[model samples]
Target: MNNQNVFYDELCLSIYTTNRYFHQLYQIVLGKYELTYLQYMVLLNIKQQGKSTLVVICRNLDLDTNTLTPVVKKLMIKNWIKREKSVTDGRSFELFLTNSAEQKFELIQIEIARIQEKLVGDDQQQFTKILSQTHTLNNRVQELIDELTNKK
Candidate 1:
């Protein structure tokens, strides 16, 4: 195979492994909260974005509505999030965090920090570099996606 093909294969495998590891670690830390990694991601996004709609959440997460709807329902049932019809768009509902979600976010931050500390050990610099690289790569990937989608 060509070097580019080999590199692509390696990159794909690395991303798959990294995703699995992160999923396992998230489960270990947030299992008690009864939230999956995706669910936590949705919550975090809403917290950061103030108020969001289901379509926005799905777009931001690169998830389909079918996959996200059930998770939103679960969060709603737990009262961790509130959903209401958007005045601007009757078909879309706005999502917001409840007081319980705020409390949970605080706890999640502490627990995540502890887990991150343990995972990084003494390699704070390496961890920071990796995070920076990941963010850059994510942005690049999003740009690629936009280009491809625009073509369609």
Candidate 2:
């Protein structure tokens, strides 16, 4: 294979493998709260925004409604979030974190920090480097997605 193709293959494998590993870890940690990673993320967005419409949450998270809707439903069922008709725009639904979710998320945060410290283990520089690269990678992926989407 050519150098570029080899590099691309390695990058894809690394991303896929890392994602799977972290996903497993998240599942184990979040299972206590009956949350999947996506559900937790959606709740995190709502908590951050204080109160926001589904559209706003989706935009902020870069997730489409189709992917988010089911997770939202689960959160609602768990009483971790509530959906109400927007006062300003009745057609849209607003999302808010429940008191319970806020409490749980705080606990989740503490647990996550503990887990991260254990996993990262005094490698602050390496962790910082990974964080920087991951941000750049995500931005590049979004740009590529936009380019391909625009082509269609």
Candidate 3:
């Protein structure tokens, strides 16, 4: 194989492997609360946004409504989140963390921090370097996606 193809394959493998590692770590930690990694992602987004519409959440998370709808419903059923009709947009609903979710958020955050600390152990510089490189790589991927999409 050519050098370029080898590099591309290695990059793909690294990304896939790292993603799985993170997912497993999240599952181990979040399973205690009966939350999956995706569920935690939704809750984190809602926590960051305070209150958000399904459309906004979908856009922010790069998820389609169909994929997120069940998760949102599950969160509601689990009493971690509550959904209400939007006053501005009657067609959509807004989501907010419930009091119970708020109470547990800190505990969840602590576990997340522990996971991150393990990954970043004794090497802040290395962690920052990887974080920056990942963001750059992600931007390039998006640009490539846009270019290919426009060609269609």
Q: What are the clash counts of all predictions, listed in order? A: 0, 0, 0
| Clash-forming residue pairs, model 1 | none
- lDDT (Cα, tens digit) per residue for candidate 2, span 12-52: 99999999999899888899988888888888888888898
> Which ten contiguous residues of candidate 3 have the minimum total lDDT?
143-152
* Clash pairs, model 3 backbone: none
A best-first ranking of the candidates according to their lDDT comes to 3, 1, 2
What is the C-alpha local distance difference test score of candidate 3? 0.91
Per-residue CA lDDT of model 1 for 4-44, tens digit only, reads 99998999899899999999998987899988898899998
- Report the C-alpha lDDT of model 3 over 7-54, residue by residue, as the tens digit: 999999999999999899889879999999889999999999999888
- By TM-score, the candidates rank as 3, 2, 1
> Which wins on lDDT, candidate 1 or candidate 2?
1
Task: Provide the overall lDDT of each model, using Cα atoms, as 2-decimal numbers.
Answer: 0.91, 0.88, 0.91
TM-score of candidate 3 against the unseen true structure:
0.90
Per-prediction TM-score to the true structure, in the order listed: 0.75, 0.87, 0.90
